[model samples]
Target: MKKRRVLSLVSAAVMLTGIVAGCKSKEDDKIIIGGLAPLTGNVAQYGQAVDNAVKMAIEEINEKGGILGKKIDYRSVDEKGDPTEAVNAYYSLVEEGIVALIGDVTSKPSKSVAQKAAEDNMPMITPSGSEESITKVGKNVFRTCFIDPYQGKLMADYAFKKLNAKSAAILFDTGDPYSTGIADAFDAAAKELGMTVTNKEGYASGSTDFKTQLTKIQGSKPDVLLLPVYYNDVALIAVQAKQIGITAKLLGGDGWAGVQNQLDEKNMDVLANSYFCNQYDPTSSDPDMQNFLKKYKERYKTDPIMFAVLGYDTAYILTAAIERAGSTDPDKIIEELKKTDYDGLTGKTVFNENRNPVRLAYITTFEGKKEKVLESYSVD
Candidate 1:
């Protein structure tokens, strides 16, 4: 009877040990990251591109060996390009115990998410949000791209110095902080550069008809027309400007990156002199950029846009911070990010006090068969 009791106790101990080991294995295998982007709305294409790049990065990181020996698990929520939806997505991700977050792609949604994440002290990085105010919210929010003010100044300076435009008119979207910020900065810079501003006009978001605005602008007869708005509005405005026979040279901020794709080929002819600011030129011969281009093409089976590169770099920076911090503490990660002077695919990324990237901006124009890089500028 004594021998049987001892054997029974030993068997129970072994079973308990196995159970604990299984639980430990499960815990060791899980690492959750959060993503928020507009997966089904007007900006869905860009959002989807960022999401794809992030997923690819996570896959590659896992293949080699994930951060701290655990595979990365990501949960992505579609913000649908709405501010409230973006806030809710952040809240949900935070509640789910995510270690980090990427996105809220556009400016407005990103701003909303950044504010909430700051309040919650979460480590969040935006792939393409460009409003100047985004990084000003707090130390917790970091952006992979330059702000709209730099982009606006880039175009304004280029217009005055390179294009030799003496006077210009501004057409901006009132509902978008991104557009408004760029327009404000461009107007200021143009005046400082001795360019006369003939007229300034504003339109609501999602407005298709700009004939009235264009009519007023045409009457001003400025040397250039600046449209610091997104692709949808840009397309409509370009088409309407052509319809109204306004022949002034058109210029735009970084928001114009994919506008040509949305415009009809015939309408694009009207914008032959159009130019915009961007962060990266895929045609760059920089060795880092070349390798990124090759790897991105190999993975996605296509060329990457500025946003894709931004998304990829954002992931790499955040992962590097994690590695440097040696833990998932938000405060520690923010400190590491502040110290980031790492060479990324875009360029050398360093953060200002506001957590915005101090980087170079490229001025690009559409030529017959390609987008030509006109110039590049770095912010001090």
Candidate 2:
């Protein structure tokens, strides 16, 4: 009887192992997508927006029977805006059997993950990493937003033709690739358009005081001051410029998208009459965009930011590629993604040879913390 009991226990253990193996096999069969975000950091707002949007898109797709007739298993990691942490997150995702990846929302972390992903030939797409070199890291890397150079040139042309500005000054963070890349392109395009670039100045990152730079730019008396920096820096610069009594029209890239939220009631006055090129116009009248806004508001109880729109679009784009490929194989998905011609909430996006999106820019401005879409510009 003791021997019989031992044999029965051994049989149960074998059965349990079989069940676990079967479950693992089933999990492996599902299409898995991993996301990396800076979920807790100074840029947490951007990361949170993207994370919410991506999950929303995945939920919507799953409700419709998911991609390739199986439900998608979405996993995400918080890298906390650190480059080294981002790479570690990618490895964790890869180990979890993810067939595709979406994220590392900011430029530097995105680049770090892309470098590692490229070595593995993993298909990865960044929703809002606009640095020119991010996609240049590997063919496997792609983005849904226009690059820094594109935004810079677009604003330069707009300033010259629409704003009728004859002179512009640039103040950027020399330590930041996003800021410096746009500054260089704007400088070149401004010169090409016969707009004088006056008093180009650079500062170290995390500097709270820009009065020194503003004073020099004030002396130049530029018709426009191009600040191709992030929203926080833009806010500080705008406040300082206003205090210094500089009247140059403020212009920025997509980095300035959420500056309105970063300012207080009194400081909001500083952004008056400022314009920035962005991914999408929050006030767009397009039926698709309106529908997305409605759904997003219903889900998040707030208006979607530019990063949210990009994240939603990236999810749709990636899923569409998986559907077109008829498989979750990374190589197959990458091939289909290359042929993407998605008319998303952001805009019609197609990957250029460099794997960057060929899309137009929305010239957006603020009116007392409300974002208004002024116009859209294509490469002409």
| lDDT agreement with native, every candidate | 0.82, 0.89
Question: What TM-score quantifies how close candidate 2 is to the native fold?
Answer: 0.90
Tell me, by lDDT, which candidate is best: 2
For 1-380, candidate 1 gives per-residue lDDT tens digits of: 99958955764565456445534443446677889988887888788878878887788788889887777887787777888777866766665667788987888899888888888888889989988888788788999987878777777888898889999999999988888888988899999999999989999888888999999999989999999987778888988998998988899877677777786667667667788777777778888788877887897787777788888888888888888888888899888878888777777888888888888777778875367778877534
- Each model's TM-score? 0.84, 0.90
Whose TM-score is greatest here?
Answer: 2
Q: Quickly count the clashes in candidate 1.
A: 0
lDDT of 2 at 82: 82
Candidate 1 — which residues are off by over 4 angstroms? 1-26, 285-303
Per-residue lDDT over 88-149 for candidate 2, one digit per residue giving the tens place of the 0 to 100 score: 67876776678889997999999999999999999999998988999998888999988989
CA error at residue 22 for candidate 2, angstroms: 13
